[model samples]
Target: MRVVSRLSRVPLPALAVASLVLMTVALTLVFYVAPNDADQGFSQRIFYFHVSIAFTAYACFAAGAWKALRHLWKRDPGADLESYVAVHQGVIFGTLVLLTGSIWAKISWGHWWLWGEDELVLFLVLFLFYCAYFMLRFSVDPGPQRANFSAVYALFGVVLIPVSFLAIRIAKSFVHPEVFTLHGPNFGGWILVTYCVAQAALLLLAYTLYRVELTGKRLDARIRELRFA
Candidate 1:
């Protein structure tokens, strides 16, 4: 709890600066340092960005679900808004995943989208489900009922994440390449380092954005309360 409180107290500007620096370094490593794939060539470079963003999206969803659990199970006063903001960040990153995945498919497979791909289809379904969440959330009035509904919906998303992630394995017809096989990782050396850097950059960027949005929302709520009072 002390650790969590310390992290929460980190200044927004500092986070923004750190995120920018890491993101710049990550992009430089991806484009310049990482070796080109012998097969896919330059196009394979997108894998660094695409996969990292997808994983970051998953992290955001998972964080949202955990916050939702806190709201419901522990009745944490601030958890509901935290969950909402996290899910919002997840959806933003999820959209980027689809865009990046489509670009990758176009370069590798000569198509923008492949409906037969299990991983692609599952991710789309997961994204759409959360899109529906925003609709449901906005349709209801602000109160405990809305909070409960959003929390339950976020919990459901946590269940979907694993299913979407493992779709390539669960479905025999999937053509998506598995990076982590039973033997080991498919790539190594700078490829691994670049990927790790990219992942860290994206996660930091997402967290920074999450904090910014959450702070703005809290300020707005406070302003409204003051006006009403």
Candidate 2:
């Protein structure tokens, strides 16, 4: 309880500053310290940022689902709005995943888009589904029903994550005869450290953005209340 209270009271500016510093350090490590892949050469550097963004997108969706569950089950105030904001962030990062992955694919295979890439295809499906979530949310009046509906939809996305991963695994046997491996058996040392740093940077960046968005939403609501009062 004390830890939670302290965390809640921490200034957003301080948090943002910390995140910026950490991300800067991580990016430095990625570009300067990480060794070039012996196989893919310089192009392999893209994997650090691309994979990190994908994982962050997954984290955002999971957070949104958890917030949605809180809204539905615990009736936590502001949980619905928080959930929506998290999902919005997820979509933004997911779009980045598509763009970065496409660039990486083109670099590796001389094609911008590959029809047989299971991970890419699965991400596309999830992206489309979550995009519709916003449309569905705004189509209804803002109230308990809207909250309930959005919560249910967000929950469905959680279930879809594992199912989609499983489907991708199954597709590898047929659609993709050759397995795609990002890291080699020799992946370690500075390469591992740099990858971990990059991953942390992305997660921190995502959380920082989420906090900023949530703060904006709260401020908007407060302004509306003041205007009405």
Candidate 3:
């Protein structure tokens, strides 16, 4: 029971501090330590963080969906909250992907945007879809009904990831026949170190944010209980 209770809660401020440290280390390494790839030059460096972040975001959403499944399937009381926190983090990183992808597109193709980039396009659709998840969450009153709907919708979002990727790939064929391939910069010892630091930092930062947001929500719930009591 003690272990369960501890598992149910997280130390938010400490996690936040650790996340900050990791991010700082990562950025420093990315700029100073990592070497540019010979083939892709400077732009190739972006892939180390960009693609990693994208994959991380996907992992988070998938995690949320799994938790949601547990919540619905096993009736785990903690599952819904855990799922919500994970989804929230996923959306934040997903936004980062769009921003970074746009920048990368400009750097690579001399355009601020390109729909032919399957990853970028796929993220845009996902961002919109998940944004609606929050909307649907708030619009409906809080109860089992809300939880049920959110869980089911989260499941849908997970399915949409691959479907959206396929859609973008197919759309790109007619939309932009010329496929612009992207290759990351050639990195040396320092650059490689920096990218690893950055990736770790980003992961930590995501977890920190998740913990903080979850804590705030839990406090709010507690306060509501007190007031109602």
Candidate 4:
């Protein structure tokens, strides 16, 4: 497999500092600026970060799947690493989705979990599916073959997203008599601005984390070669 001689030359400290500032500001907006939702009240506050993160996680997974496809079809070496890191971030944020979703469910329904909540139920399946991704990663010896297999499986995950969502929706027929809306702040005025800022900040943070982790892993590979050479 081919390797990159050097990673991109962006300043690490600057990236970290910028992401910290963004996170701080975004959290403030999420809690203080966004008005109390009429339907869900205080619990609706969690929706900002929770939904943003969930959407971001989906983006990451889609990105990973795209890279995986490139790796498999085009034989692009760097795609493998990029695909791995993206999926890794997807898994992290997916876990957060489940965590925050559970919190919201508890606040609203007095239960930590509800199988009937379609979005939450979908995330639960995604969470389990992606968790197994790590198992697949660890079980394989690192090589082109491992990369190829991971790529193929990641593609499967993307396909599974819609399938799982449909399955959850179908299951809801027997689970609940009426659908309960997951209330969110109206997309107007300051609420709109807050959601946009929060989303931008979260996406920037995900990118920063992805770059740093990718760089670190690449450096580790270089170090191993130096030590053994």
Least accurate 10 contiguous residues by lDDT in model 4: 1-10
- Residue by residue across 1-229, what tens digits does model 3's lDDT show? 4853573465667767777888777777766666767776778768768976998799789978998999899999868887888999999899999999999889878998897788998999999999999999999998888899899999999999999888888888889999877644455577667767777777777767777787788899899999999
Error of 2 at 175 (Å): 3.5
C-alpha lDDT of all candidate models, in order = 0.87, 0.87, 0.83, 0.86
* TM-score of each model, in listed order: 0.90, 0.92, 0.88, 0.91
Candidate 1 wrong stretches, greater than 4 Å: 1-4, 164-185
Best by TM-score: 2
Taking the tens digit of each residue's C-alpha lDDT, what string does model 4 give over 1-229? Answer: 1222232355777778888998899889888888888887877878878888999899899989989999999999789999999999998988899999899889998999988788788888988998898899889999988898899999999999999999888878877868777655677987788888888788878878888998998999899989999
What's the candidate order when arranged by decreasing lDDT?
2, 1, 4, 3
Off-target runs (Cα >4 Å) in candidate 3 are 1-10, 184-192
Pitting candidate 2 against candidate 3, the one with the higher lDDT is 2
Look at candidate 3 and give me any clashing residue pairs. Answer: 33-190, 33-191, 34-190, 34-191, 36-186, 37-185, 37-186, 44-184, 44-185
Worst 10 residues of 1 by lDDT: 176-185
Total backbone clashes of candidate 4, pairs 3 or more residues apart or in separate chains: 0
lDDT of 1 by residue, 42-84 (tens): 8888888888999898889999999999999999998999999
Q: Is candidate 2 or candidate 3 better by TM-score?
A: 2
